[model samples]
Target: MSNDPLLDELRAHEEQVWDALVRGDADLDASLLCQSFLGVYGDGFADKSAHVGQLAEGATVQSYALTDLRARALGSDHAMLSYRARFMRHRRNQAEDMYVTSIWQRTEGGWINIFSQDTAAGEATD
Candidate 1:
């Protein structure tokens, strides 16, 4: 972890998101996102409902690890977090690598994800 508190805090929030995916906790996942949350994935764009809806069948992700996290303040209420993620989906034998960027906004409730983008890091090797 880094010495920066913002980086650490944001990393924790990011991990929560991944944990939700692994556990298929749609409620937890929904709680972390803003009503207007937008996600850009290799497949296409997704809104908050679509993002949370993926968990309908339970546990979309099997496991995940985040690394090389970086965060920058986008004013006082917002911050951007970027990192590399290696994760395996449920029923998938191979893990996939991706670089992700997420924007979070501080609200009266707490930090909520406002936007995110994921770029595939080519293919995973054995």
Candidate 2:
């Protein structure tokens, strides 16, 4: 998380996603996503169902962490969060790092991720 007040709040909601992924808790994952949630990945975009369905398909992340988190408020009920994430896939035994941006909207139900875009952040070279 950054020094921005808005980013701090957004970071908490974003953390929920990581927690759900590492725990393989699809229900909790779904709770953080909007019904029409759209995730833009390197391959393409995934809707809320398909995104959370990865867990059901047995995709497990053994460990994960986030850093360099930054956020901007779009309006009173909306925010955009960006961060660098590192995680290992248990099935593949490979670790990956990426920069991600997720758009969240605060509704009566709470903050739900409405959209996300991930960019592969490879190893830093000297």
Candidate 3:
């Protein structure tokens, strides 16, 4: 845990998203996202429904770990969280790493993820 409470809180929320993916809990995943949630991934873009729809068949991720967390408040009601995620897909032998940035906003119901982007970590250019 870090000294910043906002970072900790956002980290917890981010973990919940990974947990939902592992458990194939579409409802939980949907609940965490705002109705207008937007995700930019290497494949393309995904809205809230498309994000939760990935688990329709079952869990897609076997395991995951988050590190190098950083968070910044985007005012009082919104925050941006960035981290490195190492994870393996279900039934896959290899793991993949990606850098993720997520934006969350405070709402009457609680905090809801409003936006996110994932970038694959490729071999070092240098």
**Residues 3-117, model 2: lDDT tens digits:** 6878888888888888888788999999999989999898888999988998995537878888988788898899999999989986767789999999999999788999999
18, model 1: CA deviation in Å? Answer: 0.5
Identify the runs in model 2 with alpha carbons over 4 angstroms from their true place: 1-3
Which residue segments of model 3 deviate by more than 4 Å? none
Residue 97 lDDT (model 1): 91
- Each model's RMSD to truth, in Å? 2.1, 1.7, 0.9
- lDDT for 70 (candidate 3): 95
lDDT score of residue 1 within candidate 1: 71
Clash count in backbone of candidate 3: 0
Candidate 2 vs candidate 3: the TM-score winner is 3
Candidate 3 collision pairs: none
| TM-score computed on alpha carbons, candidate 2 | 0.90
Any residue pairs clashing in model 2, and if so which? none
Candidate 1: segments with Cα more than 4 A from true spot? 123-126
